[model samples]
Target: MERGRDTILLEGLRILDLTYGPSGGYAGRLFAESGAHVTKVVTGDQEISTFKDSRKRMIRTTDNQLPETIAEQLAVGHWDIVLWDSHMALHLESQLASLLEKISGSCLSVRIHFPSTVDVKEEHALQEWGGWTSLTGDPHRSPLYIGGFPATSLVGAHTAAATMFAWLEQKKGFVQVDALTVVVSALEGVYTNYLETGEVRERVGNRHHTLTPMSIFPCQNGFSFIGAPVDEQWELLERWMGRAPNPNWASVDERQQSYPALEHCIADWTQGMEREELFHTGQAFRLPFGDVQTLEDVKRCPHLNMRHFWKGQHPSDGIQLPWIIYRHSSCKLENRSHSLKRLRILDLTSMWSGPYCTRLFADHGAEVIKVEAPHRPDGIRGNSGESPAPFFNELNRNKCGITLDLRQEEERAKFLKLVATSDILIDNFSPRVMENFGLTREVLWAQQPGLIIMSLSAFGQTGPYRDYVGYGPTLESMSGLASLTGYRDGIPWLPGFSISDIGAGIHGTFALLAALYFQRRFGNGLAVDLSQYEAAIQLIGDYIIEETFSPTPLQPVGCTSIAELAIQDQRPLEVKTSDGKRSISTPWIIDNPENQTYEPAPTLGQHNPLLEDYMAKREWHHQL
Candidate 1:
């Protein structure tokens, strides 16, 4: 084993955050939070207000001139990453790809922008988020820009995930994340549905196409909502309301067909009760329920205080904000490099959630073995018609792919053998799929006591919706995000991105990392039950908490930005945070996983011998 190595996850990650807006700042903040040495560079006369987005985490600032030799200077500094904001600087500088190529260094240059086409005149104008969101929402209703600004945070988070992956492999290239591309990627199925089913998902007002009883209803004092996507939850809510359960609304399709009536039934019960009484009573039976919350209620939420989420004060107003959104209870710093080269993960996930989570691991230097079925491989790979799709390549990069017919008895046994040698196993199948394959938690624990199995599902392993079907829209609706997303009094609009699935992946990554650390430290097993719906609800958790106490039901306020939404009807605050601290990151070390590169996905059954050999070794070691 290596000795005396010292670092955090991103200890030597020196980043030049030259972005001018929230997206770039959000990306920088992610790296900074992960222990990167981030320098928010001020080039030309860029306004100071740009720093307000991430002022709390930023530790360094530099006054610099972007000369003709700007690329050369960046290379000379040996910065590990340069997160450049391409949208705001497009007019002032050369095209991003060219500038990045001219720079000679191993540093990863990330370009954040709005999606564009080849028409130069048209492309630059379409970079604003308002233009993009205009294409979304009800065609009848005006194109809504929620809060009237770009959704930079969504792109920024994805950029951070990609950059960390690149950094782990010593890869040098320009990574581009446009607002348009990220949003579409988030809502991948929208295009796929159009391609396969010839149906466009319309802007349905405050309800999912399938899930019944998922809308904001008027309460005694205000409006509230419930998302009983499953039969049991609906039944439970019916019992709680002292009414006969609608036997016809047992299935999602059935519920959709009679959504108006189902909604009316829920509204009838919720409208009479006090919002607080309903909130506490419904939760007692574990109903997927909540009320709408005002910003004032969000500010004073006790749940947020219990979580330590709103620990950080805003740079301008000293108002509280979330410090840590993804929480893990145990993560200790050992005297070693934060590399996952020694770890082996069995990735049995595909189509965003599971694959994305394992990609985070693979990019962090873990040896990820992605297992696909012989008859049906990853849906993304099958969808790749001709050219290499960035959609597939980006998420499945840095992992070994092998096919296994886990349904077959022989292949299933071989999988169990492989499992005994693996550190972690991850999947996003319906809760029963693993049990059906005889890969239950009890079976896994009996064979490999220390193994960590993360079963990511739409409703988790034990919920009433455990066996229910789901998609990205299912989460958006069921999680109550759709309830508060569109214009007030208008239909609840779905965002361009599959925000829920992406969040689950990111949060799942954090959960697995913590579980792995715990196993290594305490010799214990961890089972991560990641509910996509539950994970997604965290994004709008304050809204739920607020409505639980407040008299008002929060309605969709068409916001261009959170900055606008937070201020409500008041004037926007533009307080300058000029006192950001300064610190330089440590130099990169020699002992690293940079020497290793990702093994490409194997052709079907091509690597069968490798698995057979691994099983043989496992059998020999176990004296079987």
Candidate 2:
């Protein structure tokens, strides 16, 4: 049977969704959206978001009936995936073992856990415990909650991806996805910075920790984010502002030193123009500038509308729904211990998004080769002279690293040769960077026609803002996340970390898994164009839906009061890197029979000799 682009990737997969809360609901929703037959067993009157229940078939039942419902469903052996939360697991504790036994070999069970002390209903407490509230908002004021139930949504993404990974490996035992771990994992450089420098990361309002000129500024009508981290962007900004570049503000460190003064000058210049005008003019200079948009403004965004990013309104409330747009040419029922052992991935991504995506695969036995340029490696590495930052080491662990200056013809040839032997190629460069390097999708396909190519761009390819540069903050502002995440009286605020980057990375991981499945099943190649902008908007889908039907606009509440409670476990799980540095372990916990081990991130070009040996052998194989 031939599958068209419109065909759902997980079409025939059956999922038994016994989850309550946003986390499990969202996970089940992802499965449902991918065309799985997801039967959600709603046990209580607990409110459910329309976004989470979009494509699922609901089965209303009472707490008493829940056990029987799940038991019956598992007994039939019809479900490929089973999703539930810790609360429900406790509810059916006596029968939980038996119910799980029924699907032990046939189905994959995923449990989303939170601390026993914290109630799932208390969003603020979860945020605080998860280390999110501590890092958001202004340093002096109360820490703010990231708008929408982002922590739960992040857990949902993890749950869905874990289930898919288990399914791909054909391992059907038990998987536990901790909500707090998911939140902590997305903290990016926070923990590492504290570990390395003993300096706890505090709120800096809309400013980034490392990047200068990457903060929000007030315009004539409203505020806009300006992210120009590179020296080239700084030069362009100066030219646009009609000022000669000063030698003092040349490098990143110098600009950081002069942030206050530079910010003042930029603010003065921006104050003369309206928000829209400033956005367009800044974008004209190829700067990553975006107007802080409200939910209403996001609804009317031309790029989102053109892409049909929003599904139809809610059935009962007429509220708009956000949709995940997959470009196509794209899970599972299997359990091999090392499912991806033979697979090789070429990771040409830097910073968080791309590295984070490939890291997931690297942890699960996939051979991932992280490719960076000799001159300019991943930005997260900080200065070339210093050791790779803790965050970089944490994200790039278990992967081999090699340097390739693609600008040089020799390096480009080496990269192409690598692509020929690799199964997947991942990059998060701007849409033009790849094309300019003469490594377009067409060119890559010629090297390995069955290659699964995924390009994670700021705004997607072919969109009006495709060429526009953006970081996490830029996307957050442009996608309406910043607008929804601050105090009512305060201006828009960015999240504690580059959340959009992390979210897009998880989405990319899931998409790549699906693409790999499709390739193995049908022998076809796929090109995935993932837009961080759209992924950011999807994170606030619940808010978008709620505001659509509400009489008044949604307003941000600074922070909710948290109660002191005893958590089940007070100790944080830390793993030792190859360099003896302790970092957080992988987020989720799996209870499979196979044991997995961790490895530290490789040093720059650490595996160049090994890669060269492999490439020589691959070339020899090709000649034969």
TM-score of each: 0.61, 0.90
Q: After superposition, how far is residue 524 of candidate 1 from its true place, in Å?
A: 14
Ten-residue region with minimum lDDT total, candidate 2: 559-568
The lDDT of each candidate is 0.55, 0.74
Position 515, candidate 1: lDDT: 47
- Clash pairs detected, candidate 2: 169-335, 169-336, 170-334, 170-335, 171-334, 171-335
RMSD to the hidden true structure, all candidates: 12.0, 4.4
In candidate 2, what are the lDDT values of residues 1-624, reduced to their tens digit? 122223366778888887777788878877777677898888677676777786888888887787787777677747888887877655585476667876688778888877665565645556777677767877777677777666777778888888888788888888887776677777876765556566666667668877899888888888999888889988988988899988999999999988889899999998888999878888888888888998878877888756556554422332222223333232121221225767789999998988999998988878898998888888888665248778888898888888899999988998899898777898888889999999987788778777778888888775688787788888989988888777776588888788888888887887777666555555666777778887787677777776653221232233321111112254334566656786666677764313656677777888778767766775422110
Off by over 4 Å in 2: 1-7, 89-91, 244-250, 312-338, 548-568, 591-594, 619-624
**Number of the top candidate by TM-score?**
2
